[model samples]
Target: MTDPGMKCTRCRQPARFRLPAHNAHFCDPCLDLFFKRQVQKAIKDYAMLRPGQEVLVAVSGGKDSLALWLTLEELGYRTAGVHLCLEMGEFSEASLQSCRQMAARLGRPLHEASLGQLTDGLSMQEIVWATRRQFCSVCGTFKRHFLNRLCLELGFDTVATGHHLDDEAGRLLGNLIHNHLDYLQAMWPVLESGGDAATGFARKVKPLCRLEGAEIRAFAQVHELPVAQGKCAGSKGATLLYYQKAMDQLEADMPGTKHNFYLEFLRQKAAPPPPPQLGGRCQICGAPTMSELCGVCRMLAQARQWREKRRARLAAEEAAAPTP
Candidate 1:
């Protein structure tokens, strides 16, 4: 049937891929079916997106997001793509090109925004340096802000992201280790639109939560999806990488480990006593916030201060350089 190899678990055709967690091998078609089924299961189980609710997919030009956009389109959902350009030099250019290529391939409209416009002419790296905040923290807040803004402007009520099983499993490990109950409560397959109308909050869902990162990469490869290659330069050595590596090692030792860890966590539905957090509009951007100032506002304020200092220092250095 397929390429003359081991029989596919479903159809006895030659298997092209093996899923140790499922204890099965599948041909190309079966693997495709499996991906769709898992996605469908997650969406239905969580009531993630309604039949006709417009979905604005957050595509980062990564394999996960590429797979998500393609899968949702294949599943017959009305969808569009939103990409945030962090202006990280070549990486940013490659990412935007990938998004455009995918959108062209799928014939879907792609919306683009830049870090400079989003953060008062500051890039993500600049924001991190200026605010002395973690890179991921700064990037996440800005991305959230942009996604919320796009969702409102485009009239998309549901915003879907590309978070998958491996990501969740690793995050679960960290949260469990740190005993961060508030973050635990917040990490759901579906996060409803928050804040009032002015907040530009849209319902966020993770349709790919059931698929593994490997599965997504493989799927993207098989389908020839145009996804940006290479990791962001900013995330060179993140703690989350260690957590993910630990989970990967555990999963290698025991199949289904990652899947079970994340799924069971969701199934248990344990809620800890909610942590005390501030709740008010960001005085600057007017987004919903746990604190008086939202993350973007805080970063913007610091970024401006840092920029001024940087300019002054550069001017001093240039002036002091004798005989250029």
Candidate 2:
């Protein structure tokens, strides 16, 4: 049922993969080259990286992040990895291992920061319990704060993320569905990082923004990258997953739909005007936030209070227990 005689679009070699979105077929060598070229083009078009600048890549051990890291390294950039250990049991351990292996293979230093250690001994589970928010919401806040903090403290010139075309399209679709115009406007291939420092915020860029999810996965498989195969346990039924499913179905129905939609958004959208009050740093954590306290600080405070109340309740229960 396969087309054995199909040829690659670039070369006359036998096709190894079919990319319906691009209406293209590529051999193994061509496919790998195409993947790298897309990332390089994105970086050049956006002016993401500079010569001799240190880039801190946020790696999660997944295909996208690993592929991004590998591609940047191959492109001869000064790249390092920062992985957050959320301690989600086996998945967390596997992710951390994969990240370490990736760093070792690339010969780059990998910094591991545990959530418990960073949050004053409060685990991700405790934060979720305390805040009563979605797991991803809490996790995302922590990652953003810590990633920016690390970039500032370590003197990284830029922070690169693993957001590809499919991720951007899904996020756009979700924002449209929720009428989040502000977020929609803020979405771009390159953004000024919201970190506070004397040298200004470290720019954030997405080198893989033009590639699709399937393409990245294929590249990772072809290159044999040590990518974690498991999904996050907390994101089992996340809203973003539903949005991604919808986007996938749409893309399957009409190839290039995702690319067109996201590109149009990037070209025509503008960030919403900020409120009259100027944004300032959080009193508690000293991060750049609009409010008096940053979201991470608020969550940590709630987590601490929750732990205290839980301890008191347990003590009261033990005291009230009858001798058996």
Candidate 3:
């Protein structure tokens, strides 16, 4: 619940947004300060990054990512934006444009990667329908592969993403429900780089993990950030969204529910075992993997095989058809 009549807690000016958990409201400047402080605190608490380290922010053209890039840039970090273009359609283009706009505001360039380019013209949507796999499962595999490739190629040692408290809380719920201890072990604010070449990821950090998604969106709105208007078409009906909505309801009923929930999880989780050793380097991409092919390579191989089978089937059908 918000009190529109409230004033900024710091300067007593008109409050643009209300934070129920914190019992506070803020105008624009104060909100900006609040955003920076939260991110900085998370970084400091987790030792996520060091000064002068290059940070590549994985932006999805969403409000949360934009706010993070803005806050990091404002805090004087050597940050750059990386927008992985899935080239699925309008959503990808819009996302790219938003990232470009955000980077332009700070007079910096945004780096890019493309699914089509990596897959030789196959998109994730194509792979989804052809392979009968879920959108997120297929997409996440490719994204991580490419994100790691790009981060390493561009000489960035650290990669920051926009996973907020809502994201983590939802993940925690799902993992606990399924008793997925492997994923639970991997979850953290700062994930250290892989010990060997096969880890296939940079030092990944989520500075926004301590903040709520709604609060981050509010900050973006009040600051007039250019966020992509809608979510990806494939993201509809996801179970993660359900968990997030459940968390939201809990928060509405009881303030500070989300923050306390995540903090307590971090406090009490048992010692996580070491990750399983990779089988070997991928045959195709030489990436660390338990399988013969890395995830991205396997996806591309499956996509191409599916396309070939479809073409052969169509040709056979045409050959058997009566002369037209």
Candidate 4:
């Protein structure tokens, strides 16, 4: 039992945080200990990592990711950080700096990639415009591909992400609402390596899946971890954001609703059938794809074609102009 005005659950100190999902309140130190123990339990329960295996943590300098990296390192894991700069101007630069600071604090190596480098100097906005696709979809595809490639190239056995319980619950609700069976089936704490091994699509793990977003943010703030403080510029009015808000409202109305929903999803024994194979490797990038080219490869190709057409049109217009 917890009293809102009482001392910490584990200690006599004044309580600083309350976790409604767990029905517990804790002081700063106790909260930190509780958060770390939950993360360790999640890892053990899911077998997310094996001892001595190298891990590349996908860090965005956000609270959840930075906190995850710190916790993994503290738990004696061989973890390194990878930051992808989506070339979203100041956001990208600030994220990179935060990642650098975190790596320095942990005294670990940090690898970096950028949308420009991956897309031939094209920014995310440019790629979206060139492909006429949704910004989030295009960005997500590129980041997934880029991270997997990096993990393989760097000889990491697993790639860790900062997907917490709230994220999982919200995503599940979204899938349920939209009837996205394939995606829902693929949602798990751990996903085995898929695609061609030669290209380095390593297994994915989420050690923070059992924890909530608010708790993770609290942990980060308590520890003063270096994390980017703002949301991405492009995520405004995104469908995912709407789903998250809805989940939050539901959770507020019914305590532990999110935790219960997420745990039930994991406990269900009937595994959904695997999705139908989408065919062979992409022709251009050798990535797994249903079509002739993977989404990333196809988007890049389209961007290239668009650029050429624009250049040719500009040249023709300039030629048609009278002597200037």
* lDDT tens per residue, model 2, 179-234: 99778667788876543453235667899989999999889878899988788888
Residue 107 of model 1, lDDT score: 95
Model 2, residue 225: distance off in Å is 0.4
Candidate 3: C-alpha RMSD to true structure equals 2.1
How does model 3 fare in lDDT? 0.84
The Cα error of candidate 1 at residue 161, in Å, is 0.5
lDDT of 1 by residue, 1-324 (tens): 124467889998888777888888887788899999999999988888877567899999989998999999999998899998999988889999999999999999999988787677877888888888778877877888888877877777788999999888999999999999878888888877755545646788899999888887768767989888778987867778889999999989998999899999888985322222437778887777778887678778888999999999999999999984
TM-score, each model? Answer: 0.93, 0.93, 0.93, 0.92
lDDT of 4 at 117: 79
- Distance from true location, Cα of 108 in model 4, Å: 0.4
Instruction: List candidate 1 segments past 4 Å from native.
Output: 1-4, 270-278
Global local distance difference test of model 2: 0.85
Residue-level lDDT tens digits of model 4 in 194-218 = 6555662588889998888889978
Choose 2 or 4, whichever is better by TM-score.
Answer: 2
- Report the Cα RMSD per candidate: 2.7, 2.5, 2.1, 2.7
* Clash count of each predicted structure: 1, 0, 0, 0
CA lDDT, candidate 4, residue 78: 89
| Order of models, best lDDT first | 2, 1, 3, 4
lDDT of every predicted structure (CA atoms): 0.84, 0.85, 0.84, 0.84
Error of 4 at 208 (Å): 0.9
